[model samples]
Target: MAPLSDPAPRLARAAEAPALAALVERAYAPWVAVIGRRPAPMQDDYTARISAGQTWVVAVDGALAGAAVIEERPDCLWLDNVAVDPAHHGGGLGRALLRFVGREALRRGLPQVGLITNEKMARNIALYQRLGFEEVERREEHGFRRVEFRIAAAHLAG
Candidate 1:
């Protein structure tokens, strides 16, 4: 895995709403394909997330390979969405996105960060565990079984 800065895929603050929407849709297609649904709902939500300063993208050598969005509530930072192009899955971009979000959580004085993954997505749930998150709860939401996780407050950097 290359360090995020090794060759440095261009990273920037994406304030343009449409471009962010396009990135999110493309990055999410493969996963949505699994669910057999149009990505419209997610695309709308993600565009709003970006408009609200809750997201970012990383271009692998100038082409968008992944994106992550965070929503900070009073008590916890939420990883609302995290996606990597299926074609670029094992190149460390996904881990880099998670690590970046962790740093942001610590910086904003958030004691913890939380996320939910589809219950069927066992690999994703395992990945979150590997990144230091633990399952805190589970519930059915929007017709999808969901698993929720939270990082410990003490582990946050400050």
Candidate 2:
């Protein structure tokens, strides 16, 4: 695994939208075949997201390595998109981003952080569970079968 980066994630700037979009595409490329089409996140408007201050990017030695888009909801922080460049997989960047999401939720006075993934992505589900998120529901929407998970403040405290 590549050495992890030390810099904290920063708010994404508008100029980085293309790079962020590419990173997301590379990270989710393997799932295209499995899901029968591009994932919803792959088609998101990163420019708009960044402009709204909903995106964050992490860099390693000045190179972008991962990105996450979090939406602040009425009751929880919604993790909309999280992707670590494929070359940087297994370096714990994804988990770090998740933890950041939890922290952001707490900072915003939210009670929980929630996310959803394709139901067929078993490994992703397991990883989230191991990180304290509990499977809350399963449903089909937007032509995909999704499993929703949430990590409550109490769960994070534990």
Number of colliding residue pairs in each model: 0, 0
Clash count, candidate 2:
0
Pairs clashing in candidate 2?
none
lDDT of 2 by residue, 37-142 (tens): 9999899999999999999999777667998899999989999989999988887778777777777788889999888999988889888888778899999999
Local distance difference test values of all predictions, in order: 0.69, 0.85
lDDT of 2 at 64: 76
- In model 1, pairs of residues that clash are none
Query: Tens-digit lDDT track for model 1 on 89-152?
Result: 6777777677677777877888788988777667788888876889998998877778999985
Query: Could you say which candidate leads in lDDT?
Result: 2
Clashes of 1: 0
Candidate 2 is scored at a TM of 0.92
